[model samples]
Target: MFAPIRWLILALQFATILPTPSVRTATERDIRCSVVWFPVIGMLLGVLLWVFQSFFVHHMPSLAASVVSLSIYTLATGALHLDGLMDTADAMGSRRPREAALEIMKDSRVGAMGVVVCLFAILGKWSAIASISPDHWEPFVVVPMMSRLGMIWSMVVAPSARSQGLGALFARKIPRWTVAVATCLCGAVCGLVLPFQQCLWVLLYAILTVTLFTGWMVHRFGGTTGDTYGALNEIMEWVGWYVFLCASA
Candidate 1:
């Protein structure tokens, strides 16, 4: 087995745009093995956001802090999930035959639907973050973790929409054992950072959101794709934010 730190580095390297230890010769198996560390990446991201919030929340208005925080979020991950969201939106909005819709998603150019989705997603998250009370900031840490867990769940439950690409690698290579272990780890992390009731609720929400979205992807394109996986992560974050909002309310 790859050392735990190696796996974690790989996960961090893949999930974020941050500089990390080189793995120039990393194989598909190495990447597959890294799947288990995905939640750790999320937790790392949450902690960074938490620290950013600490600095910003004390100095700036909530709305400004929220915008800056969201910008940090985009930079940290290179807006990888947001790109997925946009591509998926473009594909879904095409309303063409399955192949044609997939073609639209594969195109490098963003479509009108993609623009609309990105606009609203950013606006919605900014609004939610700004509105949330500081006392409930713990949910901020848990939300990112839940969203990464959502990505794993999507890979576990859905076939790849295409024969090649990141989605296929994950769908085919990630074992059921990894998913099981990851779930336990995520549960542990959530339990540590959130109330038992809220942790359970977010867990349920992540599962249902991933399952439902993957099912829709299957119905539309015969399976999931890298783009859809990204979309799933983005949507799950939104779900987390809204759930946190409602819970805090």
Candidate 2:
């Protein structure tokens, strides 16, 4: 649990605007902990986001919450995941060979396809969250947890599309067994935190979404990359929220 902290703190500084301690040199163990603990931070962010938004529910509309959520999300990681999401769309747009796809992803400029995809992702997520009433607070909380957990799970299991990339860095060190532990822990947390019936549905949806993403990744880009993981995070959050809330309804 403590192992990821040193590495995580450094990563977090890049992804979020947190008041972190001075950037310290990290060991491989620290890197391992980064992969493990980074997702946990996402979970914590879920809870904090919900609490913050919920506190203002009476004073603000759903759109306001969405804006706040989006703001917090962008500010949290400085849109690190979102950048990955865009890079992935550009790669997919190419529909070229694996090397071409990877090369296209590396280009700093965002392409037209990438722009539309990212806009859709943000608006899709915002609309989904914005439409929900405060009555579905649990789903809001669970959705973020599931999405982030799914990202972590993908990192553990999915092969990196390129030999040299951020996904490769994390995926390289992730033990195969870590996937099972993280999946179970995510389920256990949801079970303990969510309404009983909703718990089952949410976990199932998360697992299903994770599986579907794995398939899409392997089939389309040949394997996983940081961009795919980010897109997966956004997609699965919507899936989890939709299913969990619908089940509750």
Among all candidates shown, the one with the greatest TM-score: 1
Kindly list the per-residue Cα lDDT of model 2 for residues 88-151, writing each as its tens digit: 8898898898788888888888999899988988887777667677665666567776787787
User: RMSD of model 1, in Å?
Assistant: 1.5
Whole-model lDDT, model 1: 0.85
Q: Which ten residues in a row have the lowest lDDT in candidate 1?
A: 1-10
- TM-scores, all candidates, are 0.95, 0.87
Q: What is the clash count of model 1?
A: 1
lDDT of each: 0.85, 0.72
Off by over 4 Å in 2: 1-4, 7-11
Model 2, residue 156: distance off in Å is 2.3
